[model samples]
Target: MADSLGIRVFFIKGPASVLQGLRQAKLSADVDVFVDPARLDELLQALRERGWHDRPVDPDSRTFPKHSVTVHHSEWPCCIDVHFRFPGMEKPPRVCFESLWVNTETIALAGQQMRIPARELGVLFLALHALREPLLPACRQELDYLGELARREGLSEGLLGLAGTTDALAAVRPFLEDLLPKTTSFVWPEASVEWRNRVASHEPGSARVLAILHATWRVKPRMLWGALFPPPEVFLGTNIYADMSMAGRLRQHRARWARFLRAMPRLVRDLRGLKSSGD
Candidate 1:
């Protein structure tokens, strides 16, 4: 369907694409794909027609605009994360897709043509992963893969340059330096206080907080209000607190109200944290 719509799709940020031929890397369960944002509506409609519908998970609620729409098929074990922007970015970069498309390299996978990020961009992507979760064991493994790729492709300088462009060089440099020379038993080290502080400042939680503030106070006040108190149909359509029968719908409404009430304390705490952070 994306081909028919002329929407260029690229596999990104998953074991299938990122670790395709890398034997040592641990495989991930889901596939991540980036599509041109201009054709997002068409792509979404096409997906729905094929029985792939959105599943609003925890991350979707925490991060508003930056969240990817996860779609699933009952028969398929793996899910697809449809992204319009890079994950963890607060806002969409102006030329992200354009540049990525121009730099993309096509490869045949499972007897079908597919696009994946070129070496430089792929390394930059790995660096971004480190920024997102530097402490994870999986991230350390990813860094190992990245280090090998950089050495094999002579992409050290090019990757560093790309990181610099994203203002991520400071956060990503140490990982690359430490991981590149080692081949076994990778020992993860604690990030410096300064680096930790920098990562904290760029947290998506903070971004979500700012989004809520902007929606409620600065602009689009109605957006927040509407989200908090949307019509029943919106819930039904999204399969949130949904019920097929009239009696079930009435019960679901009451249950939803109770759930919201129980969740109020946590919501208040999150809001307070946002205010205290001065975001």
Candidate 2:
């Protein structure tokens, strides 16, 4: 549908992982499309006209910055995540889109053709996605898999260059440090504060806290309110609250605060270490 509108879009993440032979299709996976930011508003309006509407999002989700807007049709089994900027691609949205589009490749999907990032960029996409939650066991497993794949593909230089282009060299520095140890230490960029904080602190519900700290004055109040009293959708549905009872939710919230407090000393120390190294 987007393609027919002359919108430049390509499927990524789950769908691309399947096509790139990196992973098998999962039953619950949705269609994740990266759209040109310039046309995002137009595509969104078109989607609404075609019976696709923005899905309900929890107040907790609004606390943090959003990279994509989700829309779904009642007739469809899965939602379509329309992304304007992929996380970890800290560079400008259009720049990232153009960089990936340069190496775009076509593959057959359910008879019709579809666009996806090239093998190298596809692997990069997965790597960036994993680094967003580096502490998660599942994400760690995926990173391990991709590391081996990167080695097999001899993607050392290509990955490094793409990381630089996408402003991700700092975030993926640790991953590349071992994978491409042969590369000079001087070339690795310093990690950003956002990357360090997110990767270092993985406790559930901590993001809401960080969101308030990170928000500018203009948005801080909203972030604070959302953090304190997120909707039931967040309290009940999120991993932070395994049980939805009031007591259970309070316990989880306390646990999250404890974890965040514990992680802070290490996280701050790590950031200081990065800065000391000339970050």
Candidate 3:
């Protein structure tokens, strides 16, 4: 559909890796396609016209600078994640896609020709994506897999050039430290607000905390209220409670509140530490 609209689209993340023979065992949770930022709405409308619907989400969650929008159909098991920009890449969305498009090559998948990032870019993005949640067991395994890829393909300075242009050098540095020149050590920069939020936790609570942290003095009270009593849609949109009954959804919200309360102290400490550093 996007192709008919003159939009250039390409796969990314898990599907891209699988299509390029980079990782056979990796499974895609959804179909992730990177589309031209300029035509994102047209592509989204096309999907909607075909019975795909956006996830039930609050307005704040749909704000700009977000990487992707997820749409789902009742009959499909996995959602379609349409991305206009990628997280951890600080370059303008159009510019970043343009840089990456240059390195993309055609591949055959599902009986159709598709474009995916080159092997080197694939390995780099794998590290960048895994490093988002460095402590998770799955993320740890991904980092380990990245090490295997690096060893097999060998490192390249050109990968560093791509990382540099996208301002993701500091984010992917810990994984690729040995790729750096030996004479001068690389210094890590401060982590961005979004990065810290991702690291703090993958919960709406983290977004609430961040909203409070960045809220002005005058709006702090309103933000505090919002944090305490977020819209029910915020909790309803999650897969955990999507199929649950009303009572079950309420229970899930209660459970989330308890977890959020328990995690607040540690989250504060982590965010404070991140204020002065980056991972």
Candidate 4:
């Protein structure tokens, strides 16, 4: 219906709910479909053709598409999200290769790709768009994804190395600290044990790289929200806003972002020194 109508092609979220929408609606051979510029009308017609126009936006309200749409079905865990472009997202902006996507260094559940720290900085780059416009769903999702990575990865030295900019660390701190450990043991045991020990011993102070760890230890949520959620539009949403129970997680994200930045210049210098010494 969308391609026949001559609309632009956009990728959907590929969640299960979206999948059911495709099957129950009897969409088409292409799992991915193009929608016409007259998307609103076509969507309605598609819903009617499926005899599901009366379905609720989401059978479960919690699963609503951040917006209301007429065709609602049982909470399809995996739903296909169609958009004209990455929709409100900026970095992966080129329209040419729509299906091509890169993976980052995080864990993914089911079919959803996890945005790993460092490996896929493009997601982080896409974040600048959210920083520019706070309310966007993509921006919110990206931040949440980053926060989850920082939590599971434990501000690993390698992860910090990946962020590569002190400013970027500060900008992204709120999301990072959301999962930081209260005590040192909570840190990942998998990475460098020696580095983890070093971070544990270091008191919150300056000059020593320990200062970076210290800053992270002492981060507060308010500080993080102040940095990441800057105002112009005063963005608010059920999904983007951290749930009340999990509200304190953003604190360490600042330091993680900072540590990454701090390490970047040193990393460059060290690489240069290695090359010269090697030469």
Candidate 5:
């Protein structure tokens, strides 16, 4: 129905809805519907008329206006999240949102305009999801997918471009260091001192840097779980070499995969135990 109606849409999944519609519409025919954030209240009060506030929200949470509906509008019974803001740990400012409009690079997805430095968008999904506690499996899957894509295609040098601006490099240092170890294959194949310095200069919380990290790391399912609800003192300080061996080959890409094959049953049983224990 959205495609037929030529409605621009993005789906979010969570406990609340985010936006009702864009205040600024380029086309008069476009009717951007917001998922009622207080869907329960809206339904109950539908019998008694009242107003619902359609405002922006933190992009990564269900606490926005995009998550109120349980029905699939265009297809079979399902849920979808429509978003105008880039999803992140914190709500991005309105000015940052302008990046999606004029003077921004554009990509077409499902026949809608998606903002560019596309790798950065992919990274945002990975990092924000990683920040969530009691991490959801879906988030991990998304990160894994992004990682694979990054491996196949290189990421934009958003961080590199930010090197001298706003103490940008210094801000995301820890995140860079954290990512440096795990993503060397994808990110560091041709890394030089300048490149490393450029990365190291970033602020820890820079979403751009985090995006680069997510693009480089090949996260296993177990590692995904570990990242979501990590055990104390496990893989602390970015053990990038853990994925490597004494000979500097990716353990999984080498003969170590055979060893892992032998260990698979035990690993599977241990994973089952973890699930049983609710870990």
Candidate 6:
């Protein structure tokens, strides 16, 4: 349907797209794809008709942009994460989707022609992991693969140039340096204390609420109130209590309240830990 509608789609960020045919590449549980944002509604409808159902979107998740969705079909039992933008950049890169689309490469996969980021842009896409979470072992492994590809293809200069243009050189530098022969196991570079604090401050849920309260309480006092008492439909859906008798609704509310009370101790502990961490 997307092809019929003239919407461009490209595979990205999973084993098939990033690690295809690499001996060290681990299999990803699901496939990731990016599509034209304007065609999102049409894509969603098409997927639904094909037995894919939408998963709830967590409004506070900072990991993915707002124009992203996950859908699953029972027949395949693997999720398809659809994105209109790349993940985990503190801000959007200077590079844009139009340029990426213009440079995509075609590849044969399972008897179908699929599109992916061209070599230079592909390295940039994988480098996002370093910026997001450089400490993770999986991310380091990906960097290793990227570095090997760059050297083998004589793309070192091109990759560095692209990274510089995208304002991602700072994140890409350490990984490139790791490619140099070394005697030691790669020690994860420590993010500066200020950087760590900033990342933590922007974390979703309660941390975000606190930051908003601190920065704009007088101008938008409603933020705090909304955080504390979000509409039940956000979680329970509009029809949660629709068909229930008064007695049943009352029982459901009581049960929910009991669960909240039971979770209070853990919640308090988490809050204390956050405070201690200076976030």
Better of 4 and 5 by TM-score: 5
Candidate 6 has which clashing residue pairs, if any? none
Candidate 5 ranges with C-alpha deviation above 4 Å:
1-76, 84-92, 101-117, 133-138, 159-177, 180-279
Tens digits of per-residue lDDT, candidate 2, 1-279, equal: 777899999888775577687754555457889899999999999999999977756755444456888887889977888999876778889888888788788988878788888888888888888888877888898889888888887987898888888898888776776678664765666665566556655554555655566668998887777666655556443342268788877887787567667777665665566458654
Report the error of model 5 at residue 14, Å: 14
- Candidate 3 scores a C-alpha RMSD against the true structure in Å of 3.0
Estimate, for each residue in 1-279, the C-alpha lDDT of model 1 and write its tens digit.
677778888887565444444324556677888888777778888999999977655332322334357788887877788877764332245456676677678777767788888767766665666666665677677667767767787777676555545444455656556544455343433443334433443332343334555443554565455544545554554564466577976676677667666766665665576468663
Q: On residues 84-174, what C-alpha lDDT tens digit does candidate 5 reach at each position?
A: 3322222232433333222223445446654333334334333433433213465455445544444444443443233212122333332
Candidate 3 — worst ten consecutive residues by lDDT sum?
A: 57-66
- Candidate 6 lDDT over 68-167, as tens digits, reads 6778777885788887766432225224456567768888886788888777777777766444555467766766777777678777667655554544
- For candidate 4, the per-residue lDDT at 52 reads 43
Better of 4 and 5 by lDDT: 4
**Residue 49 in model 6: shift from native, Å?**
2.9
Where in model 4 is the C-alpha error above 4 Å?
15-38, 57-279
Candidate 6, residue 78: lDDT: 76
Taking all chains together, the TM-score of candidate 5 against the true structure is: 0.30
Best TM-score goes to which candidate? 3
Compose the digit string of candidate 3's lDDT tens values, residues 1-279: 766788898888776686555565766788888888888899999999999999866545412236888899988899888988777777789888888888788888878888888887887777878887888898888787777667666755766777887777767777777655577566676656666566565543765676567667898887677666666666656762463667876787688889888877777776667576643
All-Cα superposition RMSD per candidate: 7.7, 4.6, 3.0, 18.5, 18.3, 7.0
Give the local distance difference test score of model 1.
0.61
Candidate 1 clash figure, as a count: 0
| Regions more than 4 Å wrong, model 6 | 18-23, 61-67, 88-95, 164-215, 218-279
Instruction: lDDT winner between 3 and 4, please give it.
Output: 3
Using TM-score as the measure, name the better of candidate 3 and candidate 4: 3
Weakest 10 consecutive residues of candidate 5 by summed lDDT = 15-24
Candidate order by decreasing TM-score: 3, 2, 6, 1, 5, 4
